[model samples]
Target: MNNDLYQEDIKQIKQQYACLDLTDDQAAFLLRHQNEPYPTHTEYYLNTWEHHDYEDHIFQKILNTAQFDHYLERREARLATHIAFLKQQDEEIKRNIEYKKQLLSYYCHTYVPQLLQTRLQYPNPFFAHRSKIRYIKEEYSNCCKVWKLRVTSQHFRNCRNYSPQLFELHMLDLQLLNIMPDYQQFKADADMPTQTTLTFLLDKSRCYLADFISFFDQKEAEETRTKKDAAIAVFGKAATSGWHIEPLPESNEERSNRLLFLLLMIEKVPDNGQANSCY
Candidate 1:
């Protein structure tokens, strides 16, 4: 791409754009960028002079100034195009975030809680017509009503009937074994755990049939926190470069996580002007 024959083109362009008032350094910069597809002033200056052939006066005579001017015009147009693209991308990202937030909120607060209530009401929906199952559902509902009222009371831990076994029994009656492709294996597992009263079994069964509402809610919070970390990492680089980066649309969980990160970082940073002065 480098040829000494472009000297004639440079002379003619130098005469035309004399009023450009470009310094020798600027001229050298323009020369180096003449061949670039989309050059930026920031990139041009950021590179070391040692990396430039013009610093050794190699390009002073042969560089095409007219092509350099065209490059600058093209670079400006390219930058404008990139900014427009970024704005469009940001708007799309914002819309997606809002949609996800709404979905997460609905799943956590309304859909899941109602689903849990439905499960408790008809643990064996397939056999819900039977009088025996109906009686069990009624008794379980009575227990749940009592459990809820006493849950916030001081004697919650002392209540003998507030058992995890109640939850486990309800889960077993849900006919989860029938739904499995390997029903025999699951039925075998279902029979063996007939004696255990561990909370883990209750949690596992609940999670398999219908995930625990609290656990789903916790996962939603964790997802938001992950998003916050990503946003911070993205925007922090823009901040250091003196570019104005827009904050991403965040859920309450995301905002809280972001604030927590900011507070922790602030505490870690030295109060004194000097770096590493915190010791």
Candidate 2:
């Protein structure tokens, strides 16, 4: 073998020996014999030590040390690069988390509300029942009442989900989905004495929308029950009659818009020409 290659092999053997559980004196003895050439086994090294050539052994020691130092330099360089990469990854993860929080805030405060208000201005044909329209308005109002009670960032974050802005968008989407054939049927029924009774029923149904808003509140179970009972009182026996109550949409974007619209309706007051007065 080439001298360099022989030195490298000897360095590897020394490293392996260093990892063993030897006492200091035993290690010193092992190191002293490292450069001595013997047969390939430990038994031969121990048997031949007395007759080993000193000049040849000292030459092997120099080559072994040089090879060991080269290996050490390479290991140190690799470790440094690995540590630097890990730190960069940690910082990137932190930045991504902050960006996500900011995005959620913007959706809650600005984007969702604008979308809801715009959709609410244009009434959907699917909700042609005047009563259903009135119910939508009342539910919107209830959402606003609930929002006003939110106190903390966590509360605000949760309340933001039920904002009327989100609700309005969802309502529009549902209308597009054509999920309101039964509601349309009720609107088409002309045999009823006047549209007033239908309008009254619609208002009663609208009251149940409060339950949906209340669900996001801290006191969700209590408020939901209270609002549900109140809605039943308005509906009376008709509440038990199996009129189709449109299921709430599952999408976060749709639900938020729907809730926002409900809040807007809750906050609005009809003008009685009384300056700055709200009931």
Candidate 2 lDDT tens digits, 1-279: 676875555566556645333344434455556655655772233211222234235434544555445544654665456545544554444433433333333334433344345445544422455565565444433332333332232322333333333333333322221211123323343335434544454444454444444434533333344434443554444442232222433585444434433432322211321112111
**TM-score, predicted candidate 2 vs. hidden true structure:** 0.19
Global CA lDDT of candidate 2, please?
Answer: 0.39
Off by over 4 Å in 2: 1-80, 92-96, 123-279
Cα RMSD, model 1: 24.3
Give me candidate 1's TM-score against the actual structure. 0.22
Candidate 1 global CA lDDT score: 0.37
Poorest lDDT segment (10 consecutive residues) of candidate 1 = 261-270
How many clashing pairs per prediction, in order?
0, 22
TM for every model, in the order presented, reads 0.22, 0.19
